[model samples]
Target: MDFKVFTIIATIVNFLILLAFLKHFLFEKVSNAIDERSNNIKNTIDKTNSDREEAKNLKIQVEENLANSKLQGKNIVEDYKGRAEKLFQDIKKEASNEAELIMERAKKDVEREKEKAEEELKKKVVDLAVILSSKALEKDINEKEHRRLIEDFITKVGM
Candidate 1:
């Protein structure tokens, strides 16, 4: 063979041997490493997506709970308002009842006072009439005649 041909053939044989050796020893291990790294990346991305979804669900649940709590608070406030109104009405009723009772008692007291005043007035009038009759008769009678006349007047008035 020519020297150039022999050198080229030798170079080609060397390259083929190197390729076979790399295929047998290095390719599988390197490819397996790359595949493992890719799988790890995919798993990490999937876990991140699932975590995000879980966080969103938790936020929604929290919002729902807050809304329910607000509704409950509103209900409690309304209940309190109704109770307060009822209490106010009850107080008004009680006050009115007390006022009526007081007015009735005052009226009874006034009626009793009027009756007592009328009796006192009747007694004064009777006394005044007796005094006036004595003055009117004083000038017209001697003592014995006054006694005799008074007995006659008394009998006629009694009859």
Candidate 2:
């Protein structure tokens, strides 16, 4: 290389000026754009993580609510079963009481019928005794014969 002092100095100065211009205009714009893109990517990642965490919390809350609903359903079913059992018992007790009343009424009716039959029999016996006494008086027997007749009548009534 033939060393030219003025040309070499001028080329070096020109190259430094070009580098300064590229740094100020092109490199600075490219770096700013890259920094903006990096910031946007970081913000997107953070938002995605936050959203995922929120979804997890929501899932947990929903599961707890479902468990509570199941417990409530079981309690409701148990309450209905208890009510049904109580109703069945009440019906059975009522039926038993009705049967007892019917039996008691039937017993009273039987007693009334028996007493009525006894009254009718006693009335018939009294009428027959009165008729027999009148016929014996109409026969006009002697005292000893009358006594014998009365004794025979008494024995027939006893039989």
| Candidate number with greatest TM-score | 2
Instruction: State the displacement of the C-alpha of residue 122, model 1, in Å, after optimal TM-score superposition.
Output: 3.5
* Tens digit of per-residue lDDT, candidate 2, span 12-124: 99999999999999999999999999999999999999999999999999999999999999999999999999999999999999999999999999989987886566555
How far does residue 159 in candidate 2 sit from its true spot (Å)? 16
Full-model lDDT for every candidate: 0.82, 0.83
Model 2 scores a TM of 0.72
Cα deviation at 32, candidate 1, in Å, is 3.4
How would you encode candidate 1's per-residue C-alpha lDDT over 1-159 as one tens digit per residue? 447987899999999999999988999899999999999999999999999999999999999999999999999999999999999999999999999999999999999999889757655554554556679766644555555555565557652
Please state every model's RMSD to the true fold in angstroms: 7.5, 6.8
Clashing pairs in 2: none
